[model samples]
Target: MNLNLRHAVISNVSGNNQGQLQDTIVDAIQSGEEKMLPGLGVLFEVIWQNADDQDKQEMLATLEQGLKK
Candidate 1:
């Protein structure tokens, strides 16, 4: 999706707390809930977009690792 939409989803998931968003996203991922994937993708896009170079690299690396499992 577009960046704006991605940010909006992240903002919604964040619900006024940046820290909680990460945990929520991770929980969704670990839970293996197919319904949550789209929303998670939006959040991931937002995180990928806003993350610094090193963070983006690490995030992508982690995602790649997850997909291998």
Candidate 2:
């Protein structure tokens, strides 16, 4: 059985509002379970695909700062 994780993840969260999305992200991070990583990556991919250049630059800068910590 071939599964497309990105599609599945997007479908699962398709109708979520900003608050629900925030809860999902915060819950995943707080859980710190390896299994949640794929879902988080899929969410990040969705954000990256839709982000403009400035948003992407801000995200990259935030990530760079995070890596230093």
lDDT of each: 0.77, 0.91
Give lDDT for model 2. Answer: 0.91
| Index of the highest-TM-score prediction | 2
Question: Over 4 Å off in model 2, which ranges?
Answer: 1-3
Q: What TM-score does model 1 achieve against the real structure?
A: 0.58
RMSD to true structure for each model, in Å: 3.2, 2.1
Using Cα atoms with residue i matched to residue i, what is each candidate's TM-score against the true structure? 0.58, 0.92
Pairs that collide in candidate 2 are none
Show model 1 residue runs off by greater than 4 Å.
1-8, 67-69
- Candidate 1 residue 66 Cα shift, in angstroms, is 3.8
